[model samples]
Target: MLDAAEQYSREAFPSAKEFLRRLYDFEIYHRKTAPWNPVCVTGLPGGGKTSIFVAATRLLEDDTVNAGAGHVLPLLGFRHLTIEDERSELGILRRTCWAFNRQWSGTTSSAHEKTRLKEDDGFPMRDLKRARDTTALVGFRSGCCGVMVDEMQYMTQSTTANTLVTKSLLELSYLRFPFFFAANFNLVAKLLARPPQDRDRLLSNPVVVLPDTVATEISETAWKNYIRECKRVAGGVLDFDVDKDAESLVRYTFGLRRKFVIIIKSAYGRAREAGRFAAGMSDIEEAYKSTAYYTHRKDVESLIAMETSGKKEQKEFVCPIEVDSTEAMARHRMAQEEQGRAVAEQMVIDSLSPAGRLAYQQAGGPKPDAGEKSKGSGRVKTPVSSSSLLAGSDQFHRKRK
Candidate 1:
């Protein structure tokens, strides 16, 4: 799979799972140098996530778990799980354990093999708790390496922060080391403003938040990042939110957080520039225009795609996947919207054009959001519009056609 991952760096393949297989192998071999917390990937339902992983090269990972007792086995050298993209938290974990047991248990070699299969007895029990435990091991390994998660919101708390999952990962991350998250725009935002401790951990990651912006106040660096992360699978469809004016995605984000996401994305640019993703300057700036989020919250969306998608590097992954190691990121923008950026004049969004404005509203921007409290600092005012400031700067100026 490692060789395939390297090969993927050259050719475009057919499925996301194949990409995942190779990418997983590459990371497993280099687990010692992996970064961040778990990766998270998100999107609307039926985003074709499962197919991506299934298509990835197999046997890249040899670590196995016991199907007999539903026990998670330690890795031979390192580990990579294609199960991060599974639907639910329990599902991701269970699938991982099952994959392991089927792979090893002496049937072929190790205890983590899934191809080994089991007797019809179902002795492993394979209940939700066991599933969670097995998956938890995947996360536990992330502390020092990378862990992938797809549809991040589904496996977490209702709040944007996904407090429970964050808390659990944080506790274990000290030992697990690295993690990743790949989820949709909104959920990624929520996860970003995680509790102080978790947020701190994620900040250390080489995040790649996507370009599904709700508004525009973003800088040019962010725009380039987005371009680097776009992924196109079998169909002509493009994955990872690559519309021209992303205001539509904004409606799903909180205003304050939306604005901040722009900055956070910039950080991703800086990180990449400084070898955050271990990529060269040309490579980081050479790919997709979107910047997929990583850090404590990277995702398997990219991983699945990396392993399962076409082998050709159609474009730089908008987010990390295996071999790539990226995700969409989650946040809690809406949970704490402010009272609509109280200002004295008509407030304009920072980055939208006339047509872009229309697109924004059309993409779910009708409802106005309440303003949000500034992080940590209390009573911070919303940004003053440039037009408003310009107006005050030269009130005496005359305006004529």
Candidate 2:
């Protein structure tokens, strides 16, 4: 049996840090209320993606049976899934609706048939409207329903899924359950770049993205799309050691990585307002850790890099390519990161010189001396930690044991 919210503690989502605090409040409130709001946390791979549902299941199960003061029967029931699973997005919907109604939360036949059914039912989550079924999803969801579509890229582009499920999600606001769609880059890119017709479904929805905006990067609003705004948020944090050029770094490192980059890259003010920085290895790592692509970024990056770099290449490749001998493509990325890092460091340090640090404290920002410890606060972290990154890459560094 799944445990309750209280039963599941912070360790369940190690990478999420204070973020779990946000989930716990949202989950608890949704359990005892109406109009369930499902949150979609999108990010790059290795971003700690599945932790939400782990917490959700525990929250839901607790609401079902816990005797604690905070527990209550959830107005919503849920089913979680990743895209790699066989069922298409729509198929998963059908199964979820079936489970919600049965109150069993276990697998059932694919047909979604239950003896308790009358022949003319329909499913609103799937928007199933066949005249042959009696237990349609419309009635069940009229009160409570929700589905967290994890690893959403597996969501097929087929008409049944893309069109129907998309429509179903749009119409879901009428019901209590609001869908939360989270995934790595490939999946997010498909959704963001969905054709004009398909993209309309998500035009005005709320989003929270971390900084890495490649095809698989989640766009959940870690960095607003305005550089001026980012500058406002950046404040003194901008002065830090940069590995690449800030402008090019923002443009290329995670191409299309953050959905609102053009806007946020406009300024370097993050250090003052939000205390979150987004232009270097540290900022990028923090943004990534906070997005939905936790388990998906590395895969997508490798795939794209391999696809693009592998084509028309006759030369041998090496891991941990030395900075000086690296190819132009690789050099471009490093340069961008370095520039951004340098610029950010400059800004930060400039803010901290004997006189500037005092002004920073007056501005409501962390004092310059406090900068060293913020790494643990999710302000930003180094992505290419030369010392630790190659931990699992030993297989490729073979010398024939």
Candidate 3:
């Protein structure tokens, strides 16, 4: 079960199928047209942007799956490069050249060879431009499909790198190379902040990937389907009632698929440790409360805060893209109001005498009766410390009476 859970967590599920189909269509359209505008895939971290990239690469490289394989042949070769330590223009150009050469030659070139190639005057970019155009006409003639770049946020780490990467992208665009890059919220914000021309060149065909919000029936159905699939993949290891625990699970994970997988794995581990064959709601809660989930929980809280408040504080996670969060924000506000009411009710219960407290518990604990009213006071007493809690305390006190 543990091994299965680990493998399941690592597998990339298609959380954005519609967007993926559109992206495939976009690629096919561009391939027929010759020169294609660059496309940017942007989303919050863990929102499945990388999954789309993987799918796109598969579409281009796997003839069996490529829809356009019959007429528009997929690129003879494609490069999927992830940016990490290559933070300069020369470094990126050299790496690209090395990757292209390695793929085309079908041989592992040594680091010494790479250094030698880098030292040649106007070596990499010049060679790349010439080869790029020539490959389309000569030999097998399929030519190189544009590169897929991931972790693009690294490009914005320094001003020099950012300018160089932008220039490189513009050059590729000028060449009509159809490139795709995946970026997170931070990178998207930076791109939008650039001058109009630069932004247009890079983000002309932007696609935003988002997590399941569970705000509408359609979203709810999708969320449940995802849970059902996860349960199926777990192979009987998860035994919780999806209908009963779906809302709680969403509340805990904030609809992020990655966190959902983590919680599932953690819950399974907890269940196994407790001598159980399958996990349940208690196990889920235990996993959620475990130390391993602290960072994820904090991230979810930050996301909610950013969405509800519409403020991009240094401590909060914010997306510059305009997202339709009306229903989600309403639910969040309602939950906050309920929490405030609970706290106020607890305060009222604490102030009661022993007999009153016992009677209150006998009458159904903290949940006050709706019809009852406080004698003489006419209205419920509110805690002075929390003015926000005052309005919600009326019903609780009335029920208590």
Candidate with top lDDT is 3
The total number of steric clashes, by the backbone 3 Å criterion, in model 2 comes to 89
Candidate 3 lDDT, 1-401, residue by residue in tens: 12322232233112334323534464342344444467787776777776665555454342312334343433334456666655554455555555554433222234655576567554435465554433322211233445566766767777565566776666445434456777777777767778998887788888766666555577678889989988998899998877676777877787788899998899989999999989987777777777888898888767755655556774215556665567556546745654577679888886987678769867746433335454443766755666566755977899899
lDDT, each prediction: 0.37, 0.41, 0.61
Model 3, global lDDT: 0.61
TM-score of 2: 0.34
Q: List model 1 lDDT by residue over 137-206, tens digit each.
A: 4433221122333344554445433665554344333323333444544444555666776555653443
lDDT by residue (179-242, candidate 2, tens digit) is: 5666454444445565775555453343433333222223212323333354456664444333
Model 1: number of backbone collisions? 139
- Please say which candidate is ahead in lDDT: 1 or 2: 2
Q: Lowest-lDDT window of 10 residues in candidate 1?
A: 327-336
lDDT score of residue 198 within candidate 1: 59
Candidate 2 ranges with C-alpha deviation above 4 Å? 1-40, 60-78, 82-90, 102-127, 130-145, 157-176, 193-198, 209-401
